[model samples]
Target: MFAMLRYAPLLAIPAFSSVAWAPPMIRMVLLMAVAWLTVIAAPSLTPMPYWSDGGGLLLACSSELLIGMTFGLAIMLPQAGIGMAASVADMQAGLSAASLLDPGGQHEPETLLGSLLLLAAVVLFFTLNLHVQLFHLMAESLRVLPLGAVGLRLDPEAFMAMVGSSFLLGLMVVAPLMIGLFAVDLAVAYATRSMPQANVYFLALPLKIAAALLLLAATLAYVPALIERVFQDALARLPSVFGA
Candidate 1:
């Protein structure tokens, strides 16, 4: 138990760097500590196995780690896809020129709008206590899908269906911004077509930026609701993802 507790911090390294307000090493250790506590307390709250001895223990631990990672990625994939899609849209909107290097990943040209949206999502997660809820859901997952049951039988069709649905959910979350941008684009195109010599290049740039900003501001009110729905759907489908 002591040894397992000591090793708990290793699991948190990934999460530490993704958020702000901590040095890499410290955050890593802190995150690991959190994971350790959760895992240690998990079996008591749920019907999970405590540590076992022998070679099979290694296999069990590895399988648990893998399952945890898979579930984490499953939750994160939609957010990553949305961020990428928003970045692409920002690029097309001429906002790529204002890109900044994201510290979370190497050589990634992060867009201002996308970053804002991502930050907003994170804030909403915490403000609504979704993070705690996620942790609780994860804890319950151990009961539903134990260590040895990590890579359980999953239907490929259902797995694919879930992935497809997740993508659509991500798209819907960003749909409002996309629609606003599309409308702006169409209006700009019509104006340019009507008057090609009106220096639309210079005029349209600021207009589009302003319009995008306005849309983002207006849509801000809906972000918490959208994020809640996305998270709820993701959590609901987690058991299916694990083949339970």
Candidate 2:
């Protein structure tokens, strides 16, 4: 029970993060699958025998939950890079105003490119077998951070670095599109100045969108490799985050 409880958040984050765009039924199924996986692993995991007292046990569980969530969050952030890049690209392309509710969560509206990039990230996440690596990391964390001792070693610096790197990766992925859009903007500006009567705003929207799409398609081949590299970096940083 403790082991399952400890890993529940770790399992939940990746499972849900990867499939956030999926239907509720699909998310529920993945979650259930993770639950079973955790349960199966629980028997082999070491239990915290020192936390015999109620207060100590409660604290230990709390620590475990926090640690698991941290680990999961580190793993999940790289997948978000694609969405961030898309958001910036959409804004540049004038598609920011045209939005759709993100299927993964109800809170935010996503642009078309943003949605596609998000889906791509999720697909890449699975294709690269990062989920398997995540599970392996969770199991190994037991050796680094034994139960009851987890909460003390939380590394805020490492977490912040993880987040910063994810954003940087996102920017790298979309930099080409952004630069192309900027060039388009420059062309539109030059045209508008050359012909004062022309409505550049009207012409710019479709042109920018077209350029963004073309650039995106052109760069699509490299996205998986970028995602894989960023995700692997995140995974490599986990031990430091846990103070291992």
Least lDDT summed over 10 consecutive residues: which range in candidate 2?
A: 11-20
Candidates in order, TM-scores: namely 0.76, 0.83
Give the Å shift of residue 3 in candidate 1. Answer: 11
Q: For residues 29-54, what per-residue lDDT tens digits would candidate 1 score against the true structure?
A: 66666667766775653323533556
Error of 2 at 194 (Å): 2.3
For model 2, the superposed segments whose C-alpha errors exceed 4 Å read 13-17, 20-50, 100-107, 148-152
For residue 15, model 2's alpha carbon misses the true position, in angstroms, by 10
Indicate the TM-score of model 1. 0.76
Provide the lDDT at 51 for model 2.
Answer: 73
Residue clash pairs of candidate 1: 9-32
